[model samples]
Target chain A: MNSQPPAASTETSYGEAIRAGFVHLLSSHREVFAIGQGLWSPWYVGNSMTDLDKLFGKARVIDTPVSELACTGAAVGAALCGYRPIVIHPRMDFMVLAADQIINQAAKWHHMLGGQAIAPVTIRAIINRGGEQGAQHSQALHAWFAHIPGLRVVMPSSVADARDLLVASVLCDDPVLYIDDRWLYERKAVLPAVSERPLAAEGPRVVRSGTDITLVGAGYSSWLCEQAAEILAAEGLDAEVIDVRVLNPFDPAVILASVSRTGRLCVVDGGWRNAGWAGEVIASVAEALDPRQLKSSPRRITLPNAPAPTSRMLEADYYIDAGHVAAAARTMLAARETAS
Target chain B: MSHRHWQSELAGLADPAQYTAPLVIEAAQGTRLMGLLRSMLVIRHTEDQIGQLVVAGLARTPCHLGIGQEAVAVGVATQLRTTDRVFGNHRSHAHFLALGGTPTSLIAEVLGKASGTSRGMGGSMHLFGREFGFHGSVPIVGATIPIATGAALAAKLDGGDSVAVAFFGDGATEEGVFHESMNLAAVHDLPVLFVCENNLFSSHLDIELRQPSDRISRYAEAHRVRSLTVDGNDLLAVEAAANALITGIRQGAGPALLEAVTYRFRGHVGPNEDIDVGVHRRMADVSAWKRRCPIKRLSEGLLAAGIVSGDELAALEREVVAKITDAVTLARRADYPDPSALHDLVYACRP
Candidate 1:
């Protein structure tokens, strides 16, 4: 299913890379279709799916009614009938309305059918945060889905993965929850031609190399870790950055190796503190490694366990950014130095 | 205008004795009518065997018996093809059997054997008979309505005449997704038949207490889809309505609804008549509903039409009982799935 590789890489934003993925999949595959709310409207879904309906025809790129459960369940049914469909939920918070179809139906269909059937549907849930959206509008519930036994959760942190992971997800015969962050849409990179690969081959990658501390994150949190690594570099503390691309069926080999070498760990997560993806990452590392190997105890920078406040002033304290990650990394190093 | 109540118009139909008249058998329907009767008998006997299994403690799964609601499934299945997809709710044994699913596979599934339809992973609530056009069934009420709608969308996109069917109960209409699916199917003009087997009760709660109206086809009207309500105990009525609606759907007439106002002789979940659970249900209602059994009415019609003799009807019952007994014996002999391969099917292709 690999398309022809481009002769040279082209500069592309994260949002455009996603569009490129959709374009490539729709152009190449006949069975692929996209269905969801606001798929045709740029104001709702941003530049990611702009004019896709016009490009691929309204039949293939369906802009459905504002029924989350029905649309999601419809996409699943289409998938069962030999169609590869991508159901886009404009916001992760509202996607909760269709949690039954996603968690119970899509995820369990193959297993419950004893491998006789497959719901090869990709659910693209975008995390829209900040700008005083508050509470119901802002959430990153990737942990809840990653906890499911039958789901494959992918969070694309880099521009190349933004496009490539979307391609891999739709082509995959299993249901995948491909989460993208609105915060990382502006980040640009030179993306190569779409080189299709199995989703199983993708996992955590060491984006930056260092020896002092390891920064682990996925999606926007991975972007924060990259920014934090740059800040730590200026402060004479070299930090290794690991992007956990696939949250479900998470391969801790890369992160374990990075933390084993760096001797310190600080995870940056966009979700809440308790029972969060950050905690799962920490637990995975803790389960595999001995305590004596680390220079200091692991630290995690996450949102407070409270609903997002609407006030602009409180928003600054509510959301986790690069500065918080940098500060947390600095404190972890400082604590290790004091102990030594 | 003051709103007219459904209880008054529907009172005669639900009286149990009202629709006991034998079916008007046409010369052309002799073979077809007997086939329908055989299908309903198969479901009744198969579920009867399952009921016995539940009583004997051999069936550990939660078995929702559609004992008296067999006509709805058999009637609808007669109009469907192998290419036309069908989905069922929790009470789906009748649906499966009517769609040509073997009793052995279903019994094996309930017994947690390797030969089960779901390979013993899913019990009575979850079943898949893809060859018979049964996509699957789940215990979640109204969950498959949208799924069948989606399948209809697929059928439309595939440029085929095949339609999709969702068999749900009156209780499922209360779910928001059901309305959403109806609206979506109607809006898209998708070929889907929404079959509501209005069994008068959602679990232990009666339809009167659950919804303002006892008639469920009004929801279809709310979505602007063509609909018909029929006496579910009458096999011919359901068959005729399903035939018209399914034909219309296949001919690009978009979605339709068939509300078969039926009754389950058994309780909500198991084989027992749950008259003690709620104030609305009683021994009288159960006995009255039993008198209006779909199998009995159809058999009486066949006898009245001289299509079969009294000895033939008795002999047919014995034949069905023996076949079900053999299926159960074989299902019991089937081995259980290996515990070592518990995680074999977690994902189609594990990452």
Candidate 2:
């Protein structure tokens, strides 16, 4: 069991890494660019997208006119015309405004055209930060995108992984959903190297390893699980924490491999609990592995079905903190120990 | 004299006794116009065949056939090119055919065969032809209009002379996005053309019953877009409107509107003109529309001009029927999409 994470994978916060990576890609490729409402503005909202406009030029580092729907449609149009636009929706909450462009157009165009047209557009959506932004802003809607068939949904938790995943997403020949939360961007880590041959790269790259228990996490929650693993490791628990960077085309091979050995799994997604991405992962794991392989039942930690709370106090009270994640992992391990 | 050969209801629209002006067949327009006429005829015939197929339980798709609305597509597409982007609504057979998509693929898609435009997945509603600049024709009423506007903005940004066209029905105007799109296109001066087929019935309710005024061009005027109103069944009128608007767009003029005042012989939903009609548009109105057949009018004018003899016109009709028959047969025999194709097309198959 390769319990120890490689030093190469360790880096700065997921946010900084993603921004640095985007700046690098935008600088290297002219056709590639970043566009959003606060992307290249004087007041940069998505932390990773700061200073991108100055480095990449105004044409590439575009600032939209507070129109999510228009910009997304423009991005799709630009992509169809051969320009790879890395459109930033900034907040997952605003994606509802762009639903027509996302669902009816972007996701269905290639198939509608009988695969003659492939929109190589990448949208970076900030999601599930568990902030005081309330129902309007704080949302983990990765599952919404994951449910869509044509889009490649990505959720990067760590800085280095954020850069790697986003760079990889841009190279994809189809539309990709590169989502990282507002809170996750400021969280720094080491930078990871990029895959040069992205065309051959299919989906979800596993960034962490474990044997005793699988801690499946993505976006900010992945980091939460990693922090939780440290607290559990001190108590002599060998928990395998897997950062589910790519959410939509979830890598079953890596996930199943980790779960097969561990025999215990816990999916921690910041999305709403009832039918969040955690449910999808849990369901998929159960379907893929035989019942006998399980030493303990898989579990999940997610947001309650209610709308995100409004006040900062309520937000802090409701956040799925590292302590909550550790306790969940501890409970899983205890359950397995009891079963055995 | 315009030979009034319309169905019983449409006979009064024009006087058969008086001479109706020739639709004309100039030296340059003969070959291309003939091709356009044949394309519209193919669409009309395919829908008729699909109507039968639906009854025979061969096809399960709910096809919105624009049989009487052929002139709109043929007329507008005559001015379009491989570079211009086009978006269509649920009834987009002529839209696809006008942009040069194969009749076989159209029939194959409607038949839910793998040889379909959408590989049998999207059926009748969703069709696309990007290589030929037919972006997509979706079922969502006014969804693609804004997309076309965005595409027009992109063309302008890229410094391309290409224009984007949105082919939607009068019902689609009710969508908020349609107004927003027109406003954006006009203010941005994007090279986009809005072609509204005001067939007067959105699903069942008449345009008059819905809007305060019967003229949808009023909305275009509200957006400050240069507008044109024409008889949709007149192929020459459609062509003239399309040519003028397309030319204006390519010349860097902002978005323009061309509203073709026409009527569909069929019902709102399918090949049958009988179902889904409101209490207002009577059988008499549909029968009256028969006198305004764009194909018949053009053929009569051509026959009178000696540009085409009666035998030549007959030969053309026979050729169209034979071609459509062949396309249908080929489409029917074509393969269905493999299951593996289902997963691959959704995401970017980078390899």
Candidate 3:
């Protein structure tokens, strides 16, 4: 197993890395255009698209009106006509308005045209959770988009993955849905001078490795798993942290190998538990590995099947955090002891 | 036919008779006019064949026939170059045929044959022909409208006068995407021509029941897009309106909406008139609109001007029938897609 440390040369926030990545792509490629409702506005788009209009001019960095469906459809059309268009949906909730274009036109165009036509449109949908944003605005609709056939769904957890994945998705020739959680925008991590990860990559990555139990997550949950691994380390439990970055072209080889060695698995997901992405992971691992691999049944840590509550207390209880992940890992370890 | 019943049905819209004026071929480009007439006849005969196939239960797909709406497509296509992008809604036989997509490929697609335009993948509602600049058509109400707008944006960015045309129904105007697309095109000054074939019925429901007024071009006006409303069945009128709008779009004057007030001779789905579906579609209005048939009106003008004799028109009809017959036979003989080929084209992996 070639489990080496991430090549970190400097430290940076996730938001900074994403912003820098876009800036670099826009500078290098003349065909790429950053367009959305509040791309130029500081308050609406945070530091991700900050000063992009000033740097690349308004034509390349367009600030569109509050028209998600048309704008997103326009982006798809532009991509079909040989322009690499990056559309920011700012919130996943609003992206639902443009689902027809994204799912029907962008995703199916290549196949519908018998591979003669392709839409290289990257939709950066931000998962803005918590803080009384209410049910409508606060949603992680990664599983919904992942259910689609011809879409490349990716959730980057760390600053490095965020930077590299964004660049890869922009350059990829297929329709890519790059999901990023707003909560992790401030999270800081060491930055590699060059991409330490795979360039034309697909599948999960082992952020932290161990022998006992495996904690699998994607996007926000992946970061939580990393923190949970730290807490588990203090508790003398060696839990492996695997971030399933690309969910659509998801290769289960790395995950299956990790599970076969570790013998215990705890899948963490930001979305609801029932029929969620985490369930797919757990199901695949269970179907692959032998029962005599000799450990406890895999557990899935996810939100209950309910709309996002507005109250801060309910919000806190509703979401799955690092502590929750740590507790799930400990429960799996305890089950292992009982089985032994 | 009860004129009172028809009048009540078409109460708000302008007089349908005024728009359906008998075409005049006097000094009109005789060869081009004759070509347009032949194209209309081909569409009419092709649709008639489809209607028969649908009744025979040979065609299992849902076919939205544009029987009486031939002039709108023929007229618009007259102004379009092979390089300009054109998109269509569920009913798009004329749009494809007018753009020179082979009748055999279209019939093959409907029959789910490998020789189909979409390679038997997308049956009737979904059509694809990019070589003729007829970019794929979707069944979704307002789906391809914005796509055409984006294509126009791309054309502008590519530094050319290439125009993007979206052919949709008046029913699609109810979709927010239509309004958004119009606004986006207007805001960007993109070279897009929004063509709304207002057949006045959204499936089974009448436009009277759907909107306050039958004039859908008002929505185009709301978006600040220059629009022209004409008798869609009148080939000359539609051709003139489309020519002006397309010319402006090519000159970079921005997006324009051409509302062609036309009617479908058949049902929303399948071949029948669809009045049996308990909907409020007036039989009298159907009869009245029949007199304003685009093909009949254009032929009448051609005949009056002696541009095309009755014998020539008969020969043209025979030729079209033979052509469609041959296409149907070829489509029937074509193979179904290979079973192992099912996994292909889901994602276009970059080579």
Candidate 4:
């Protein structure tokens, strides 16, 4: 497993990395354009696409009206016309209004056309939660999209990947759902120079390696796993951290391999517990490995299967944090040692 | 004008006598008129054969036939090039055939043959012929309207005179995306034409029950898109209106809507006349609408103008029938796609 240690050089925030990605795409490729609601406003999209309409022309970075369905469908249409368009939905909750276009039209176009055409459109859906946003505003529905057949679901947990994956998704000739969390935007890391690579070359990556327990997560959950690994390391309980970069087309090779050595698994998912991505990861590991190989039963930490509450106190208990993940890993280790 | 004014005009056109008269074909328009007539004939006969296939239980897919509404597609497609993007809805056989899509490929598609337009992947509702400028058609109502609008945005950005055309029905106007697409195209000044083939019924329900008014152009007007409502069964009217709107679009006049008021001879699905569905669609209404058939009207007008003799008209009919018969035979004999290749096109291979 290769670890991506931050270099001692210039640092970039996850939000700024996304901005730099847009800069690279717009400056290098003329066929690429960004369109959606509040693209020109910083308050809605944070510092990710700051003043892109000015750097590029307003025509290229279009700020459309509050018409999610039309804007998404239009981006798909432009993609069909051989342009790589990124349609941003500031809040992932309202993106459900445009699900028909994303699911039925864009995702099915390439296959429906018998591979004669492709809608190389990237849908940048931001997961906005916390601060008492209520149920309507808080959602990370990546699992629903990941279940789709044709769509490529990508969630970048690292700062470098936040930028590079956005670049790769746009350049890719398939409809990709690029999910970025606002909580990860503040993350900073010293990065290498931008190197364009195919999204197919990316999958589950091990960020931190240890043989005690296998910790798996995606998006914000992946970041929590990193923090949990640090906490576990200080207590002499070594944990291996695996960030699921690409959810769909998910390869269980890395996670399965890690579980084989550690003989223990714990997955953290930001989505709901029922039919969540955490279950999928655990299922993959359980389906492959023999029960005798596993010293303890696998475990998954996820949000409760209920709507998000508005009060901050309720939210503190509702959402799973790094502490929750660390505790879950400790419990698994303790249980396995006791069983032995 | 007031909203009532447009509704009154639509009501006037809906009168059966308004479309019974022969079209006025001039000497200079003989060739173009003949081409339009031939194309409409091809669509009608081709759909008639598809109905036969449905009756014979050969075609398993849901087929939406636009038998009487051929003038809308034939008229609009005649003025478009292979580069101009075109989109359609569930009832899109006319749109496909009018844009030079072969009867063999279309029938092969309906039959789920390897030689089909969608390579046997997409059936009747999901047809694609990008080479002929028919981008695709989906069963989802009002799905492709915004797609066509976006294609227009690309056409505008490409700095080309090419435009995009979206062919939908009056029922599609009820979809929120339809109005949203119009607004987007208008705000961006996109080069797109919204062609609404208003047969006045969404499935078994009449438009009067669905909306405050049966006229769909009012929605276009609400979006400030310049629109024209014409007798869709009249070939000359549809052609002229489509030509004018397309010309304006090419000249950077934003988007335009052409609402062609026409009817379907067959049911919403399959081969029956649907007169006995026990809905508002009575046999009397169907019989009257058939009398105002677009193909019959155009053929009579051409004959009256001395563009073609009686024998020539008969020969054209025979020729179209024989051609479609041969195409259907070939399509029926073609092989179905191998089951192993089903997953090949789910994702595009990286270049």
Clashing pairs in 1: none
- For each prediction, how big is the interface RMSD? 1.1, 2.4, 2.0, 1.5
Instruction: State the lDDT at A278 in candidate 2.
Output: 92
Candidate 3 lDDT over residue span A1-340, tens digit each: 1134445554678887788779767877788998898987897866777788887888888889899999999998889888989999988999999999989889998776666788999999999999899899889988888998889999999997788888888888889999988888899978775342332366788999999998999999999999999999998999998999999866788899999999988999999988899999998898888987838888899989999999998998899889988987888798777867
For A202-248, candidate 2 gives per-residue lDDT tens digits of: 45445556677888888788888888888888898887888777676
Given candidate 4, what's the lDDT at residue B250? 95
Tell me the spans in candidate 4 whose CA falls farther than 4 Å from its real position: A1-8, B1-9, B275-280
| Model 2 chain A lDDT-worst window of ten | A196-205
Checking candidate 3 for backbone clashes, the offending pairs are none
Tens-digit lDDT track for model 1 on B1-351?
123443634657667767877777776677888878888888999999999999999998999999999999988998999999999889999999999999999999989888999888888999999999999999999999999999999999999799999999999999999999999999999999999999888898877777777778888888999999999999989989999999999999999999998899888877888542443458788888888888888888888888988999888889988999999999999999888546878777755
> Candidate 4 i-RMS (Å)?
1.5
DockQ of each: 0.78, 0.36, 0.62, 0.69
What tens digits encode model 4's per-residue C-alpha lDDT throughout A1-340? 0125345786879998888899899999999999999988877899998889878989999999899999999999999999999999999998999999999998898787677789999999999889899999989999999999889999999999999999999998889999999999999998778879998788999999999999999999999999999999999999999999999878889999999999999999999999989999999988899988898889999999989999999999999889999999999898866877
Q: What are the runs in model 2 whose C-alpha is more than 4 Å off? A: A1-13, A51-59, A128-131, A192-211, A290-292, A335-340, B1-36, B277-281, B304-306
Q: Give fnat for candidate 2.
A: 0.46
- Residue pair clashes in candidate 4: none
* Stretch of 10 with least lDDT, candidate 3 chain A: A1-10
lDDT (0-100) at residue B224 of candidate 4?
A: 98
- Weakest ten-residue segment in model 1 chain B by summed lDDT: B1-10
TM, chain A, every candidate: 0.96, 0.91, 0.95, 0.97
Q: After TM-score superposition, what is the CA distance of residue B134 in candidate 2 from its true location, in Å? A: 2.2
Weakest ten-residue segment in model 2 chain B by summed lDDT: B1-10
